[model samples]
Target: MPCLPHELIAWKILVRLPTKSLLQLRCVCKAWRDIISGADPSFSQAHLDHLHQQVKKPYSLLIAPRIKSESDMEDPRDTRRPWADMKVTSPGLYLWEESQKDIATLLFDISSFPAEGAATRHGLTHCDGLVFLPAEDTVRVLNPATRQIRVLPWSLNSVAPRRCPQGEGHQAFGFGRDHRSNAYKVARFFHRETRGMGGLGMEVFTIGKDQCWRETAVQPPYPFVAGLTATFFKGSLIWTIDYYSPMYDYSHLDDAANMPCFVRFNLEDESFSVMTGPPWYKGPTILTPTLPR
Candidate 1:
């Protein structure tokens, strides 16, 4: 009976620790490993919830392209190789903490990239605690706090053509959670045709599942701004559809294609719905809607 009580106490104490610590503890023993295995359905949600709570104290910002100024000081996100002769620029992250403003706020050490051994680019889409990085031919998802990284398989969007008819073969990626399946998914929208960009195709890749890119039956009503990234909210992926209205600009639309709005693709049904956009904005517009994490 004494042994049973002590074992129960240890388990209880273990669950309450930070998930990173729990992951390291898994290697301690078989019994401890099973306590936090991914096979256990409840483990993931509890771990994510705990992480969500912990990161809130010091809010994390998901930045893209470049967030820091260039200076003579040593920078970890230098795009050039160690022995390179020319200059290259890579995406870098800056963290904001209320109490720690005096110290430098970069996430990784000054000499390391986000993924230690990989090519670095300047595009990232963020959802939940993970930031999804897109390179020329690959996609990587990183959990900033836990130091976890996942590289996705090649998909339709990965191999984009050199030139596109509509707007230079633009592709946008979305990452989000599906509550119904309790799975995280990466969504890609791009033109599949080599010569034409008439309409975009949608493909989904579920994390931890050995599934190929599953094509969706639906496509966006208006052409997507090839450069814009998708925003995640309420189990849906949102993006600003870039199209000029006939009433305002005669080049992009007629009576047939009047206007398009901010659009959302529901992760569950693999379908899209047009949402209200800005009443007035001259340049390319993106709807900024806030959803609780």
Candidate 2:
């Protein structure tokens, strides 16, 4: 029997396997290991391209189920807070497929990197098959297919005032890739005090490079809606504009100026731009990706 050529094995056959399987097969031989995990990125890029072309339907759902900590179970005070039961021993991600409606498989767990205080489960942000899970003050980036995880540095807002009115001091986070540098970044928008004045500030952290969060000179035009995820598209993270608040100056506008808008932050330039929202649109709006025709 004749064996296939090196090019056929690397590009044609290996590129079609799932990430998890490829990672495991890396140990089978030196050639396979180099092709699967090496300094050169051509093979990996080809694999990603193949995966994208093969995906026709969105059947995968990343789920992080909330589990109560042992301390919460011992306390019979009956806490009514929603996140009271969010902390647990080992939080995990479950993948639900449309074909297997009743069965959800556990992909990985994050018990190794627990939050400092009570852990709050947030929605998972998916970018190029990577999952970004942001907790209270820590963020975890996970590759569900390979079960590899990275816990980012702690993000703190030290300059924020100790107390503020409700809905005034809000913090929102975003995760996206910078196309120019081909690096992934995590962005945080929070309330900060500068020169005895209150305003919204932003800080960014580059994964696999930055040791700490670097504060960006440019600030957000408007505060972000709390508990809403930012949409990543075309090298930018976009969020629905929150209503004008006293924290930032709004004296330049009248009552009619208050309306729904979009604040786009370019990951490459680290700048913000205000885009007008749909006219006569009412209620909440979530930014989502549309299939290209």
Number of the predicted model whose lDDT against the real structure is largest:
2
Q: Model 2 misses residue 124 by how many Å?
A: 2.5
Full-model lDDT for every candidate: 0.61, 0.69
1-293: candidate 1 lDDT, tens digit per residue: 34555346444676568756776887877776776655565665766666667645664454343323234227666666442222334445556566766554655322234322122232466766667876545677877665667888787455444554442335667788888887888887776554334346778888888467887777666555554567788899887775531112324543332345577889887888886545564444444444454
- Candidates' RMSD to native: 6.4, 4.1
Instruction: Give the least accurate 10-residue stretch of model 2, judged by summed lDDT.
Output: 160-169
- Runs in model 2 deviating more than 4 A are 1-8, 75-90, 111-122, 155-170, 195-198, 255-260, 282-293
lDDT of 1 at 175: 85
Candidate 2, position 227, lDDT: 43
